[model samples]
Target: MNREAFYKLTYGLYLVSSLRGEKKNGFVSNAVFQVTSNPPQIAVVCNKDNFTSQLIKDSKLFSISVLKKDANPKLFGLFGFKTGATVDKFESVKHITAKTGAPIVVEESLAWFDCELINTFDVGTHNIFVGQIIDSDLLDSESEPFLYSYYRDVKKGKAPKNAPTFIANK
Candidate 1:
């Protein structure tokens, strides 16, 4: 069977942020999705070893910033492509502290969601964190969401090994 077909599936790029005390980190992910309406729930898939995962475990809080199409690629390089253990991910970016105390990027984002972890499911290499939406807001009226297809087909972006969408080409 051909695995290349998996690349055609559509998704959206997002930055998932988490914080615990002074520890804070974020990374680009396409696995974020809305799971419910009433009470409003959302899920985020995080690599087991990601620093943000540790933060989420300790704080039980997170925020998602829907990136606009025009967001700088450098932002992804800092927040997505690199590990937050060595460097400060928020130093190079502009953000605000949510009521949940999670750092959220408000710059060039179409929208944002503040979430409280309700439950979690361990899925081998990743843990799926389902959270109850505590708050949400539209940051910009005319901003266009950055599509995963645009990252691959248009901008030629590749999924990181930890990304849920990363399937080995065997």
Candidate 2:
């Protein structure tokens, strides 16, 4: 089986965040997608080992911040490469607490969605968190969404080990 075939699947870059009490955490993800339209629902796939995953489970809330094409490279370094347990990822970033109490990253984001976790599914190394969209807003009307293809092909970015699309070196 050619793993490279998976790369053909389109994905968008996003920051998935959740708050457990006063502590909030976020990570860069490409596995977020809309699950339904009528009632408005979305799903985010997070590695079971991710700190943000547990936070989302415990809080029953999450926020998705859609990244723009011109998003800062440092945002990926801080949120994607570093662990939130050891680093304060939101310390210097501009963000706001959503109605669901999840942190919405405003910096370098084109849109934001506040969601209430409705269901969860265990999928081996990752957990799929399905949420009902509680509230959402568009921040930049003119900016184009950041795509995973652009991240890989243009920016030459690599997916973290925990990412669903991560391909280990053979």
Candidate 3:
């Protein structure tokens, strides 16, 4: 089985955030996708060890901030490479609390979605959280979405170990 085949699957980059009481956390994810259209449902996959995953489980809410093609590289370093356990990822970033109290990253975002947790599925190392779209808005009408391919092929970015698409170097 060639793991490289998985790389051919298209994915978009996003920031998935959630708030638990006073604590807020988020992470860079490429596993967010629409699961249904009739009831407007989407699913986001998070690693079990991720701080943001616990926040999402506790809050029963989350927000997806769609990154633009020209999104700042530092955003990835702050949210993707650094752990929210010791770092306040939102502290230095420009963001707003959604109606669901989840943080929506405004900087370099092309669109945003506030969601309410509807169901959860345990998938080994990751948990897939399916949510109903509560509210959403477009931030930039002209900007193109940031794709995972671009992140790798152009930006030469690497996925964190916790990411669902992460490939170990052998």
TM-score of each: 0.95, 0.98, 0.98
Candidate that beats the other on TM-score, 1 or 3, i.e. the better one: 3
The numbered model that scores best in lDDT is 2
Q: How much is 59 displaced in model 1, in angstroms? A: 0.5
Off by more than 4 A, model 3: none
lDDT of 3 at 118: 98
Clash totals in order: 0, 0, 0
- lDDT of candidate 1 over 1-170, digit per residue (tens): 77788777888889999987887899899999999999799999999988899999889999999999958998778877899999899987889888898999987688999999999999999999999999888988887899988987888877778888886652
lDDT of 2 by residue, 1-170 (tens): 99989989999999999988888899999999999998999999999988898899888999999999969999999999998888888899999989988999999999999999999999999999999999999999999999999999999999989999999971
Every candidate's lDDT:
0.89, 0.94, 0.93
Per-residue lDDT of candidate 3, residues 1-170 (tens digit): 99999989999999999988888789999999999998999999999999998899888999999999969999999999998999988889999989988889999999999999999999999999999999999999998999999999988999989998888981
Clashing pairs in 1: none
* Candidate scoring better on lDDT of 1 and 2: 2
Query: TM-score rank, highest first?
Result: 2, 3, 1
